[model samples]
Target: MSLHEILFIVFSTVVLLFSLMTVLSRRILRSATYLLLVLVATAGIYLWLQYEFMAAVQVALYAGGIVVIIVFSILLTHHIHHRSKPFPPVRVITGLGVAGLGAALTIWAILQHDFHYHEAEPLEVNAKVIGQHLVNTGDGGYALPFEVISVLLLAVLVGAIVVAKKDKANEQTSENK
Candidate 1:
């Protein structure tokens, strides 16, 4: 009916389709690309909610940064299973059962609760307030989480380096053999 409603429908459909594709596709590269599409569709939904900053962050971080890194990791690691051994049967069944249980729990919780919306005061997204919050000593400050995230990034970088080196070593050993 409305543009917003149409956008919501489109984004929701795209996300669902891409997510299904991400799971169903056998190829690692294709699955990664589909997952990227799903993230982009989620970003579009964030934009529809008027969270432009969050939407941009989702696209840049998930699609551009994380997804690229993931694809690269897959390429470099080369641990992707071929069609003959896509996954172990027991692991696949366990994952599906867990996923089904989680879905059932979420649906039950939704059915049990009656949710109502209340409009809250919007926070200012100005640079000055954001800067203060980023480095402030108060409860509203996000400095701790920000610092922790930097540590996480460093860990990820180190892990990526280790994985890459391991892959290279395996390749060299196989070649030598």
Candidate 2:
């Protein structure tokens, strides 16, 4: 096998293994750590595909930003070594069934699609062009989606803070009583 194929296999394996680990882990903190590994592996795949910008964003936004936020939330709300309750047999079976169905559908779709490769000149990509596109509101621009996501993230942060404060308030009231 070629070096590219080897690296792809390695990255894919890491991503799949860590993704499974992330879901199956009983400890919230461990799950978050596994998710971080999965994200980093995904970034490796992006780097292998020559999408440097995408790889950086995956590492920075997902592995760095999102995972840190998740870890912090977990630390703030739960004990560090807390473990999740075991899944009931019925729930486990249902989850497996759904996962099987999804996998089957994905494989079927892949089989039905025809992909063709074409040789094309590589386009120049840089931070300046990316910045312009992000701010542009015209055709093919991502300004609207970017702003929407920013608003959504802000809302989520506000909601989290409110919930945390409410919980503390309730705890204080109970203590006083």
Candidate 3:
């Protein structure tokens, strides 16, 4: 096998394994760490595919930004070492069923696609074009999605703060009582 194939296998394996660990881990911090690993592995795959800008975005946005926020939220909860309760059998079964269905659908879609490999010149990377595409309101622009993601992150931050504050208030009230 070629080196590219070997690297792809390794990176894909890391992504899959860490993703499974993220879902199955009992400790909240451990789960977050596993998710970070998964994101980093996904970035590696993007890099391998020669999408340097996409790989950087994956690393910077998802891995660096989101994962850091998640870790901070977990730390703010003061439950760094807390373990989540084990999933019930029914929940486990349902999760597995849904995952299997998604995987089957994805495989079927891939099989239906015509991915004829062609050796073409790489597209030139231009910062100005990329920036315009990111913020443009015209066709093929990503402005809407970017705004949505920003809003989602804001919501997560607000929710984390509310939860942390509520927990502290409950603790103080119980102590006074």
Candidate 4:
């Protein structure tokens, strides 16, 4: 097989394996670590596709920023060695059924679609073009959704802090009594 095909297979396998590990892990910290692996493998796939900007964003924003925030939140709110309780059989069966249905639908859609592949001149991908696209409010602009996601992340951080503080306060109250 060609090098490109080999690398794609490797990256895809890593992503799939780590994704399952992330979900099935009982320890919250381990789950977060597995998620980081999944994100990094996804970045590898982006790099293989020659989307350098997307790969950088995947590594920097998702692997670096989001995972760090998740780990920090876990550290603040729970013991380092905390393990999640086993999911009930009903939930497990439901989750598997949904996953199977989604996979089947995706395969069906892919089979039904006719993809036309044509070689075209590559567009210049630079920081300036990316920055403009990000800030532009016109067609294909991500400005609004970007701002919304930032606000949502801020809210999540604030909520984590509030929960941690409440836990500490309860602990102090119990000690005093």
Candidate 5:
């Protein structure tokens, strides 16, 4: 009935649709693009909820940064247009069963829970506070996790380089043969 409700419905629908498309798309690039749409729609929901700072971070880190990295990775692998193989019938049926179970559990949980919604005054976003929490050594600190993720990304890049070199080497050897 209200504008906020209408926007929430729209954004949520966009997110769900794009998320489904992202998972189902055969082309790697199309899947990545769909994922980007899902992330942007999620950011819109954050904005609608008046979490402007969170929305900005979602757009910047997820929609902008991660999606760009994914797209570039696909391009670098020369698999931007690669079509994924279809799942076997048994695998597809199993996957559908698991997904249905999860959905049913989620719906049951939502129906059982009583959520209290309170409209609070919007607080100012403090960058300093956010930065401190990100690096804090105390409880709920994300410093270690952030470092771990950086290491993981570095490892992935190194692996990609190694694979690419091997492929080139194989090609050269075959040509020589």
Candidate 6:
């Protein structure tokens, strides 16, 4: 097999393994870490596919920035280590059944389509072209999304800090009393 094919296989395997671990892990922190691994592996796949810009965005935004923020927020909470165990099995089984059915439907749809089975167009890798298309989308300028994303992240940061501080304040007041 070619080097690209080998790397692709490895990336896919790692992504799948970590994704499963993310779902199956009992510890919240461990599950978040596994989720980080999955995101990083997905970025690797984007890199292997020669989407350098997309790969960098995946690493910077999802893997590095977003995951760190989420993990830290959980860590910063009041004794997340003592979080109650996950809920009972009825809802869990229902959710899993829905997920399995969705996956099967998605697979069936893919089988019915001519998706990637034939190469109709060549993929390009130029920042200039992408930037132009992003702005030309009229309604969805890429720059607009970037600003929106920043605002959303900022909101998450502020919300997490407020929650952490509230618990700290409550603890102090109770201790004083």
Best by lDDT: 3
Model 2, span 1-177: residue lDDT tens: 999999999999999999999999999899999999999999999999988867887897778877877777777665569899999999999999999999999999999999998888976779998788888999867788668657866765676566567767888899999
Model 4 worst lDDT run, 10 consecutive residues = 140-149
- Name model 4 segments beyond 4 Å from true: 124-131, 140-142, 169-177
Count of steric clashes across candidates, in order: 0, 0, 0, 0, 0, 0
Off by over 4 Å in 6: 78-80, 116-141, 169-177
**Position 69, candidate 1: lDDT:** 76
Which regions in candidate 2 have their CA more than 4 angstroms from the true location? Answer: 124-131, 138-140, 166-177
Model 3 Cα lDDT, one tens digit per residue, 1-177: 999999999999999999889888899999999999999999999999997867887898889988888888888879898989998999999999999999999999999999999999865669988888889978968898778778877987888888788888898999999
Global lDDT of each model? 0.84, 0.85, 0.89, 0.88, 0.83, 0.82
Ranking by lDDT: 3, 4, 2, 1, 5, 6
Off by more than 4 A, model 3? 124-131, 140-142
Please give the distance, in angstroms, between residue 25's alpha carbon in candidate 4 and its true position after superposition.
0.9
- Reference-based TM-score of each model: 0.80, 0.85, 0.87, 0.86, 0.77, 0.77
As a TM-score, model 5 comes out at: 0.77
lDDT of 3 at 133: 87
Question: lDDT per residue, candidate 1, 31-135, as tens digits?
Answer: 889999999999999999988977886887678877787777777777566343478889899989999999999999999999998898998888999899979
The sequence of per-residue lDDT tens digits that candidate 6 reaches over residues 1-177 is 999899999999999899988887777778889999999999999999777878888888888887888778777774657545786899899989999999999999989997465555875849887778677636535777677778978987887788778888899999999
Model 1 global lDDT (CA atoms, 0 to 1): 0.84
Clashing pairs in 3: none
Q: RMSD in Å for candidate 4, one decimal?
A: 2.3
